[model samples]
Target: MAKTIHIALVGNPNSGKSSLFNVLTGLNQKVGNFPGVTVDKKVGSCQLADGLNATIIDLPGTYSLYPRREDEWVAYRVLMQQDKEVVEPEMVVLIADASNLKRNLLFASQIIDLKIPVVVGLTMMDIARHKGIQIDVAELERELGVPVIPINPRKNKGIQPLKKAIEQTALELYKAPVRDFINNEALAPAAIGSVKELFPELSDYKAIHYLINHESFALHGHLQEKIESIEQVNNFNHTKTQAEEILQRYQRIGSILKQSVSEPSPLKKTLFTEKLDNIFLHRRWGYIILLAVLFLLFQSVFWLAEYPMNIIDWGFGEISSWLGNVLPSGWFADLLINGIWAGLGGILVFIPQIMILFGLVTILEDTGYMARISFLTDKLMRKVGLNGKSVMPMISGFACAVPAIMSARNIENKKERLLTILVTPLMSCSARLPVYTILIGLVIPKTMFAGFLGLQGLVMMGLYLLGPIMSMFVSYIARFFINIKEKSFFILELPVYRAPRWKNVLITMVNKAKIFVFDAGKVIMVISLILWALSTYGPKEKMRSVAARYEQQIKQHPEQEAELNRLKNTELLQNSYAGLLGRSIEPVIQPLGYDWKIGIALITSFAAREVFVGTMATLYSVEGGDDADENTLMEKMNAAVRPDGTKVYSLATGISLMIFYAFAMQCMSTLAIVKRETRTWKWALIQLVYMTGLAYIMSLIAYQLLK
Candidate 1:
């Protein structure tokens, strides 16, 4: 409490930085936005053994001091404390991967030159050992002039020592054990002198950094003017200086590694990762394995969640029936039991499937197989005018399109990045799951194929793939129209495989479920109440006429009173606000086999694709009347019929609806994000028109052919 120690965790991509941060801070982490950037500011606080608290900022994973991407700039800025959103760190915790020490040591050496006290948290020691690499931690520490504590955050080992190192280093003002990694006096000493003269109170390393990055640094007005003058006066060449410094640093790093680390003959043995990659990354089997993995994922989403979903459906139905019987018969009671609760129940029943999807995804990411997925799909990406990096946004699109589109910023190629953003919405996100689940249940027969794969699951997986498949096709066409000649680059590091960290997986599942319940659940509830109100009320004159007509017919034909009642219910719905709204759009969607009720759901679901289930639940429950019936949403939808007595959800209509959702940009958030990411309504508006037109054409064809 007395001293707020700020520790910044820095490392290259796939260096176990995230795992270490998660272990160090646990649930104390909070995500916020950094100043002047979209990059997330991840800060967490942990209590040390001596009751001291440390705030650790997990800066973006970057390779070196020189910034290239926005994320790298974010990391660079925070380390320099040039931004208001970041605190000046008391210590820098460099997460060096032991298996890839040569490259990691390069970045660590750069930070040490920054002269901000540094402690290296060495990770992946086990993987290093497996690869027949031995590291003398104490010797490496002596050479780097910092504490190189070997820790496995995934296994919860050596974390206390990491914290202790952080605490002790903070007390000593991050004094490095070895001080100078390279003789800065020889490398760009003249440029350093020019910088140090202007900013008299800077370290040798800091002065050189200023000389290299002076144009981009936070210096302003007269100070900036002086730096520019100094640059011109000294003819400070950034490229030449950078290359020279790298050469010198590596020369010394080579000597340090030769003394402190030993590696077995590479020809001696094969690694477990190599054995696994043989199948997973094979030219032919790799693609087959990828498809199988995807098939299983979607298949399990249906099969595994089936029992839990049925229980939730049945439980909600019982509660609705019980409430209908117990509460006094009134409009308020009807709304309470049917409108709000039923709508909510529809969304909640989908939690199991959502949890399963995120859980499985977390496992893939933990095991480092996600990178392979990107790698495998790179060739396909190139066919669409994108490269391997584009796969990340497309993969993230399976969760939600907004963040997925934001993630497109990682692709440095402007043309490829824009195309990625434009098509990312084609990936069927979790928002579309509700629509998929209900329709799959209604139309896809619960039959097994090849003994293990269920027919319904196959349908589900096909629907999921529909979006991305269409996206690639769409991009192939769009590339010719929007011409931006830019080179595509993709350099990926395949991380060493490790066991799935169950705690992280569980945390991801729980967080995703909570987001669905608390965030999406709120939207569903509001729309449900509004739909209930519209369906329950009508124009005063029209309502009175319909009611009087129905009453007279029922009295005149007592023997056919049940038919009259059904007609009366139908008439009331026709005159109601919701019904009229649906009727207005019915003609357009009717060709796709949707009736007025389905039309209403289609309209409301533009707010969110998942709202279709909630809208269906409320509207159907309202039409079923104030009776105690234990019918699930699927059952009620199945029993629904038109005025002429035809079924509402025919196989053609169900398939058409799924096809429509798979292509349509029905999510407002996605559009907003598109506009934000592109920095204009021009691109987002074009995307909306393109996607909607495609959806309409596809759905029309599907219905026409199936019907």
Candidate 2:
């Protein structure tokens, strides 16, 4: 066992920080929330040039030390050790975008002055060269008094050199600057000198920060009192001092970049990104392009998943049939075949869709197009009592509302932020994918539309559409009811488009699929097994009476054996515990065109909406027995018959169900996350009440009109 060198990688957004991380850690990274915060903290292990293990923490990207958003604060806290839990960084890797050296150096300069050992990993040198910009790495290094390594993580160049620099810096082979870009003593002499007495080890730069954010630092009694007294005596002004500090840093950085870098004359060329954004960012056409992109995304989920989904469905069916034939016919065999395999298969079949959806999303993100979506949607968001920042969480809700709600912490406006959290779940998350895909396939026609589009795919697009439309409508109404007057703003950066990294895309696809299969699979399996038990056994006397009644009927009317068996299964199901509960609640949901089968699903899906398909698979398998092997879940659901002999999956019933799931607060994980983020059950309960009520009303109206 050996100690690992702790390193923090800090950079501006779009500085190729994440690309470098991916290259360093590959699939070795683990993502978790920072202690007591919802923002993600990504950690990974990589071997240094000296063959020693090192831990790399990729901090949230930020432009400066002052933080307006929660993510920015996370980086600030770790760098400042504002929390007791954060591991102290032995070395800081400042990733500078070579293409944007001037602005990048502003943050780079800030870190060097923090008195920590630093190694500057200069990235995008080729991009800078392509733009007719040249950087004198030696000059920049000499000016900043830190080791500068030119690296391209994408091309796997200079990584060894960067690692070597980190190792040397950690070993004190490279010395940090004794004096940084700005003279802190000249700016705040009294406060800096006084803070140094309280903490002898404090650098002039560290003392300045202590003066500015001393309230956040771990200080007690006389130490804190002395710092406050110094600030008061010197008339320290935070806003004025920060502005002065930034101006001074930039002034010195500007002079250094002036001699060290060269750029082409302005009249010679324009960036290719600007040329592309011209059309993609057009006021009128931008909206149209965004709509088409979303249309293709939802359509692709169904269009691309069909082949793999069919394969998975067939594969699971074969396994279940083989087990049934090989194992003796009994409760254990029945449980393995119908209970476990059926539920697990129903959930697994949708993994293809989940992977494809997430893969495309990751591509959009890596290529820097996702930011454009948020930028384009800002106007529409504001009209709904939110700013463009809300679009990030809203789009994230398409994957899952729990993370989406957590992301809303970046929203500075309390009213808009809360509104975003409350309405985020209305976006059709992938959990609802199984429910939507199955229902749409069962009820919607399989015809082609306009020569290429499938009707079922179009129906899925429609299901996704309901999420944003209803979210806007809800946000509009909510804005009027919940009054808060905090001003909101939207400032987003659109990074230059680049080829998406296929490796990152694959990783995201695999991770999302694994999470759905392993995480959701666990819940679906336990619940399905419970459901199998409830649907299999009931009160002893009632079960005996049903068995006796069916046995006599079968013996007396041998010619009617086929029909008798169907009745026997149906009657037995009705007498079972789940059946009794479903029947009791059936009257309440009957008007929505739901039968006991759907009622049971509704109850089970409260654990998670993805469990809906699992519940159906188990129910249908328990009732069908060997028929379950020949017919897929969708086929079985489509052919389902009610007591009155009508098809259970009528178009009206399917649409009503889709509408309900589209708006319902069906995910306990989402509800729990909401509680944790909002810090009170009050808002969570309000969210639960309003969302469930809306789902019920919308479903009631849809079923009544369509049926």
Candidate 3:
């Protein structure tokens, strides 16, 4: 039998832990939340060797075992084996950046002192050498009492050796360190001894952590009291002890590096990252470059995706037509074609745009420009009662608010984090892309300016930018009322720019497309089917009367059979159950230039923003002619007319709807995540009410002004 062993990959932020996990696990990984926490838990299976399988756990990155943030607490719990659900790793792979060994070694030394099996995977060796630094791997390994493998997971260098080392280490019995990385016993002897009394199996270093961080641990009340008594009796000063411990570790690390590593004097040379920051980080030019980058991103979403989108549209239409011909004229056939297929086609046709949008964003992240975006916007963010750290989550809102709000855990300041979570959904997520694209096509011209700039693309960029702009205003006002008084700071590390890995980019694009087609598709499928029923069948008496009236008209005007049939279908749909429901809300949304059909879509799409398109598809398909000349959703919407014989999707209506979607908190998932992250429905409810009110007011003004 091939027994499985557990291995954990741990490292600091941006130390290439995820990159290595991706390389080792390939497509054999799944992402989920940790037990009792919303922090991401990424686990994957790997074959180390014959009869030895490895389950790789990628822990969230942190500077040290010291816990502050929720994610840090998760990493600490798993490492200490205190978490009942997450099993402790048999072996730990400590990813270290060769370029910055001193800071990296601080964490490595702490883990070593815990007496667990550790393997140091040294990354960024090329970057280190480029900076005139050199390290002897054997000497480092010997000094740290672990196997140090110099590997570059990004380039697929030395990965086989790294895996073999993990297998060999896991199979062997773990050995306690012969000596502590630093004098753990000397730092706080009395407290360590007292804690060890409670936890007899703990190492000297782990005991020291227990004394320092006992409050955060999952401990019995009596046990907590005992630890507090130990702290009081010993007159322990946590801040002073932490500082002394760090100073001692750095002294020993400096001694070890003198024998194992060499580097040029810091005063003599400037690194490449600093040199490039001159332009990309420039005060004035930086913003210009950011604008240009954003403009290009939005433009590419339309330009590159147009052909593929059209093909998908044409393909779906052909399939629907073919099925309509081959199948019998009955209820099942109508449901299959107009209900299910129509909904699916509406959502799937936008996959090309989603892929391109995510692919470009991935490139920005891989090239390290995304961090620079934070740096450039830090001043503005601070003015709005936030800092540079809030910029990442706000930008991540472009993908989805649920994850973006969850990512706010990295923000150390509670008030700013809450504010960030509250306002992130205001940013236009990918779900809004279909709505924006369809509406923009109706309202904005595809004219090109200066033979290069696209008018429609420019509008798309404005919509994305609008969310952040509004978020700043909202946060600035809300900060005064939320009475959390704490000092906030923004300290960020800017990684060196490198060429994006094309493989990763492609993988990201494929994964995003799959999520849209599968996850969002399921929701769209259900809504579409339900909508078909509602649009097809009405109250029995009403439905019978509609059929009777249509039959009489067909009998009276037998010569105009095709035209009369089209009129009959429209009348049948207008009086159906869906139409009745839509009409009930028509009075409220009519001021925004929406009809009853649009009203139905608005109500159902609260489940998810993208469902608006699927809802529209079902409604129009039910009313559309059965002839083969039926148009796409966009064309149908464009040709649609109100009862007054005016265009349904006129310029005012389209723009007002776009503005409405831009500000509305329409996603229930986003609201749920906000409540979970904030740990209170009060904030979530406030967010919902304010965003909805803002969306309505702004949309109303826009519609009335244009009308």
TM-score per prediction, in order, is 0.80, 0.84, 0.84
Q: lDDT tens digits, residues 227-295, model 3?
A: 999999999888988899899999999999999999988785777888889999888898999878866
Ranking by TM-score: 3, 2, 1
Which lDDT tens digits does candidate 2 get at residues 178-247?
9877986788888788889888987887788888888877778777888899999999888888888889
lDDT of 1 by residue, 76-115 (tens): 8877767665778878999998998999999999899877
lDDT of 3 at 160: 96
RMSD in angstroms, candidate 2? 4.7
Better of 1 and 3 by lDDT: 3
Off by over 4 Å in 2: 1-3, 218-226, 322-350, 389-465, 479-487, 514-537, 551-566, 590-598, 604-658, 665-688, 702-707
